[model samples]
Every structure is written in structure tokens, then in C-alpha cells.
Target: MKEYYPPPTPHEHDIEKMSNRITNARIEELEKLKERKDELKEKIKEKKDKMKEIRDAMERGDTADMILSSSAAALNKRGKETSNLTNEDLLEIQEMAIERLEEQFSKVEEELKQLKDMESS
Candidate 1:
């Protein structure tokens, strides 16, 4: 005598397709998140370089050219505003950029965790 097995449920294929679709979407989202993280890193590097240039100009006492290039002030008033970026202001700006980078890293980590969870499920 031959054994008999019941046919699979009609919704099984649909469920499988849905699961695959969700997985693919999560993968795409993860890729996008990684790209965004890279972009943020590049931005951080640019900001650091800018801060370094400003610091170096200040140290050399040759900030006139740097300030003039960076500001839109009238030639007469240029000396008053742009060169007034104290060390404190530079430090504050750098700190803010660092904080923003940290926040972006945290968000990327969280998204990675979620993607891993979805993959496991």
C-alpha cells in the first residue's frame, strides 16, 4: 500500500513570497543606511580639515587671507567679523560635529541590529 500525504496549504506560497519580499526590502534599507554612514564620515573629515586650517592660520597670524576667503563681509568690515572666531568657537563647532557623527553612528548601529533581527526571524 502507498502512503498518502496531505497537500500544502494554498497560502503557504503567498507567505513565502511575502517573507522574501520583506527580507529583500530590509537588505536594501541596510545598504542605504551604510551609504549614509559613509557620507557622514566624509562630511566629518571635511569639517575636521576646515577646523585645522582655521587653527593653523590663527597660529601663524596670517588669518587675513583665510578670513577673507571664508567671509562675505565688505573689505572694510572683514577684519571685524571673520577673524573673531575664537578658539572657543572653533572648539564648540568641532564638538558639535563630533556629536552629530556619534548620533549618526548610533542610528546606523540600531538599523543594523534591526536588520539582523529580521534576517534571523
Candidate 2:
């Protein structure tokens, strides 16, 4: 004897359609979240690079121009003569700016962590 399978009832069909819609909506949300996570990671990397560039420029002394360009206002505000600053002094000032950048980077890192947690859930 042959076995026969019955077609789905209307309620069953509706439930399947609703399930697909929920699944698609979830996939879209994850995609958007992944994109935002990628963006935050890039920003954190750029901030790190900027910190390294400042340190490298400070070490060489030759690229004083690069360091000076960013820290000139701070030096001027302190009523100090920019031309007279020792390499060590410039490094110290740059360290302060780096500290500020690090604080901002930490906040971004926390946001990225939150995104990761959300993605996992």
C-alpha cells in the first residue's frame, strides 16, 4: 500500500510565514550590528595609530614639525616659547594628549564590548 502526506492547513501555513518573517528580521538586525562593530573597531585602530605616530615623531626629533603642529596651542597657552622646548618637554606634552586619546579609546572599546554582547544574545 502507498502512503499519502496531507497538505498543510491554513493555520500551519500562516505560522510558517510568520516564522520566516521573524527570522529575516533577526538576520537584518545582526547585519546592522556587525557593521557598527566593524566601524568602531576601525576607529579604535586609527586612534592607536595616531598615538604611535606622535610617539615616533617625538623620538626622532627631526619631525618636530608634526608634534608642534598639534601641540602648539597648548604650549602657547602655557606662555612658553615653543622654539625653546627640549625634546623631553615635547614628549611630556604629547604624553598628556595621548592620555586623553586613550580615555576616548577606552569608551569606544566599552561600546564595542556591548555590541559583542548584543550580537551573542
Candidate 3:
């Protein structure tokens, strides 16, 4: 014949303390996530604002004027500056700026989705 042993039970106080600790940890995690989300939102807003500024500058013909007014040495980093900038250069810069902003927006959106999934889990 084999003797049977009873399972050990946790004390009520210990159980309650453990539950509280878990809850507090979860709450802290949520708060940190929310804070990060807010920060990301702010960054997105700033990027959008910059994109708008760039668009507005292009629309007002300010970009061309500014480039034309500045010395080639001042505008070009390579020191092999051309006497005149082509429309293509301006368009390319604008396109690159827009693409960068879009990339940032997408990355933040993905992060937000992951955070939501974590919260649900």
C-alpha cells in the first residue's frame, strides 16, 4: 500500500498579495504603453505638419525661389553644385520627404497594432 500526500494550499494573504502584484504590474504595463502611444501620435503629427509645410512651400514656388537665390555652394553638399537645379531635383526631394513621412506613419501604426494585441492578451 502507498501513502497519499495532500497538495499544499497557499495562504489567503499570500494569494491576495500575489494577485495585487500581478494587477499592479499589468496596470503599469498598460500605462507605459499608453504613454508610448501618445508619444508616437505626437511624432506622427509633427511629421504631418512638416509634410504640409513642404507641400505649401512647393505650391507657393518658394522652394524654387529659395534654391535659385542660394549659392550653389550653400545648397549642394557635394561641392559639385550645378549652376541651376532641375525641376526633377525639387520633385525628387518632395517625393522623398513624403515617402519618409508615410514610412514613419506606417511603422507607428504597426506598433499601435502590436500594443493593442498585447493589451488584449
Candidate 4:
């Protein structure tokens, strides 16, 4: 085995190596998260299609970018209240639909939670 020694002062390369390792790890986690989000979006699409098909089978119908602007308009402190919402929020988000909305809401909420955790860490 080869023994490694630190220089009198560890060089930029060592610091860079550590930073690079952390960055690579974060990127890998982000990639996995993106992949998961994609999968969930696909599943959501499939469910929405199924909902449409159900409606179509019943009534014969078929069918749909978005941004918020202005920093001046803001409200509420963001601790647990804003960024982290509750089960009631989940319920309200799904209040309009039958079972499908609830299912999708749960999935979406879970995904949001995971992303939030990643961001926090």
C-alpha cells in the first residue's frame, strides 16, 4: 500500500477535489430526483388519460407554460407554514375531484416533500 502525505499546506487541488466530490454527489442525487420526477409526471399523465377515458366512455369527450411575476407581491413567512404545507392542504388540493385527484395529490405532495428535503440538505 502507498502512504499519502499532506503537503506543508494542502494545495488548491486537495480543496478542489473535496468540493468536486461534493458537487458530483449533489449532481448525482439531483439526476436521480429528476428521473423520479419524470416518472411521476408520466404516471400523472397516464392517470389523467385514464380519467379522460373514463369521462369519454361516459360522455364521449377529448381534450391542454405558466409563470408568476412581480416580486412586490409577496405574503406569509415561509417556515413550516409556507414551504411546508400540511395534510389539510393536500386535502384542499384534491377537494374538487373524486378518488383520482386524491391519489394524484398524494403523489405530488410526496414528490414535493422529497424535493424540499433535497433542497434543505
Candidate 5:
């Protein structure tokens, strides 16, 4: 019996190289996901600040931008929150909210999940 380290073929080396490339790509994909989640978190904070501005405008009887800005801010905030939701969390939130009982809790739970996932990941 021969103790063997067979000479690597071109095909074999290509396969190993392709595997490494795939692993690198997967890592980049995960990094992009992490970056997107972080961006959404910052967006949520921006939406909160924008909402405060809109509320102040409304209180001061400045309806010119209040209607548009307030609605837009709400939409932005909702989008930011939803982007951070996992598939399961989203399904649960949708179910709870649609039920219309303690509906606000659904939103709170979703936001909490987003925050927790963001932190842990």
C-alpha cells in the first residue's frame, strides 16, 4: 500500500477555489444584512425626530407641512420597524394586529424583536 498525497488536479483546485469564493460571498451577504438592519435602526430614530417636528408644527397651527410631514414620518417609522422584522415576528404581529385586541402590543412586540435581533446579531 502506498502512503499517498496525490498531485492536485486543475479541476480539484478549481473546486476548492470556488468553494472559498462562495464562503466569502456568504460572509459579504451577512455583512450587508447587518448593515441594512443598522441603517433601519438609525432611520427609526430619524423618524422619531421628524415626528416631533411635525407635531410641533401642528400644535403651532402650521398645517402647511404638518399634514404631509406627519403622514410621511409615520410611514417612514412603520417601514423602518417592519424592515427589521423577521418572517415569524412579522406573521405574529400581523395576526395580532388584525385581531384588533390589544393591537398596540403587536407593534411593541415587533419592535422589541427587531431590537433584540439587531443587538444579538
Candidate 6:
């Protein structure tokens, strides 16, 4: 004879539904975090590329004598010589800024790892 089983109680069904919702929410959160991490990586790469361009320009001595009007080149003096700041000094400042961006990228990487661990558990 087959064994008889009772259907799940109302409370058990509610609990199961809630658990599924929580799992879905966690998955969504993880996806968003991963996306953010990717964006940060891209930003860092772009910054590095820009830094290289700045270095090349500095070496040519062209960028030092004039400033580009674009917001990105806003720091340039537009042919007005800064008494105290050299191209080398400006390059150093750019390096410092890149270092800060790298720090932020590292933090995002760490956060993504933590979220992955949580998802796995």
C-alpha cells in the first residue's frame, strides 16, 4: 500500500515563499554589486590611459606652454605661465589622483569578493 502524505500547512507555504523572495533579492544585490565593480575597473583603465597621454604631452613641452579649453584640460594655463608650477609638478599631481582611483578600485574588488562569498554560503 502507498503511504499517505499530508499537504504543507499554510505557515510552511508562507515560509517557503519568503525564503525564495529573500534569495532572489540577494541575487539581485549581487548582480548590481558586480556591475559597479566593472564600472570602477573601466574608470581606472581610462584614467591610466589619460595619464599616459598627459605624460607624452609633457615630454613634448607643448602641453606645458598652452592649456586646452576642455574640462579635462582645464588645469592647463592657456599660454599663461604659472610662476610656481612646472609640467613635472602637474604630472606628479596626476599620479597622485590616479593612485586614489586605484585605491577605490581595490575597495570595490574587495566588496565584490565579500558578496560572492555571501552568495555562495
Candidate 5 TM-score, C-alpha based: 0.45
TM-score result, candidate 2: 0.50
What TM-score, computed on C-alpha atoms, does each candidate reach? 0.71, 0.50, 0.50, 0.42, 0.45, 0.73
Candidate 4 residues 25-112, lDDT tens each?
A: 8777667756766765676666566455444443532110001111112323222222343333433433434355446656756766
Residue 58 local lDDT, model 2: 68
Q: Candidate 6 lDDT, tens digit per residue, 16-100?
A: 9999999898788878878877887787788777668777777777554342325335434365434455567666766887788
Candidate 2's C-alpha runs over 4 A off are 61-121
Instruction: State the C-alpha lDDT per candidate.
Output: 0.74, 0.67, 0.64, 0.52, 0.57, 0.72
> Candidate 4: RMSD over Cα atoms?
16.6
Tell me how candidate 1 scores on lDDT. 0.74
Q: Per-residue alpha-carbon lDDT of model 2 for 1-121, expressed as tens digits?
A: 8899899999999999998997687677667656765665566566567657667876675555546665776777898766666556656665666566567657656665675586588
The sequence of per-residue lDDT tens digits that candidate 3 reaches over residues 50-117 is 55665666677665536455465564756665555454565566567657756765765676577568
Model 1 lDDT at residue 12: 88
**Candidate 3 — which pairs collide?**
none
Full ranking by lDDT: 1, 6, 2, 3, 5, 4
The segments of candidate 4 whose C-alpha lies over 4 angstroms from its true place after superposition are 1-8, 11-13, 60-121
Model 6, global lDDT: 0.72
Q: Which stretches of candidate 5 lie above 4 Å from their native place?
A: 60-62, 65-121
The residue-level lDDT of candidate 3 at 93 comes to 64
Quick one: how many clashes does candidate 1 have?
Answer: 0
Considering summed lDDT, which 10 consecutive residues are worst modelled in model 4? 63-72
Tens digit per residue, CA lDDT, model 5, 76-116 = 77884213433344335434443442344355456556655
- lDDT-better candidate, 4 vs 6: 6
Itemize residue pairs with steric clashes in candidate 2. none
TM-score of candidate 3 to 2 decimals: 0.50
lDDT of model number 4: 0.52
lDDT of model 1, residue 108: 83
lDDT of 4 at 30: 67
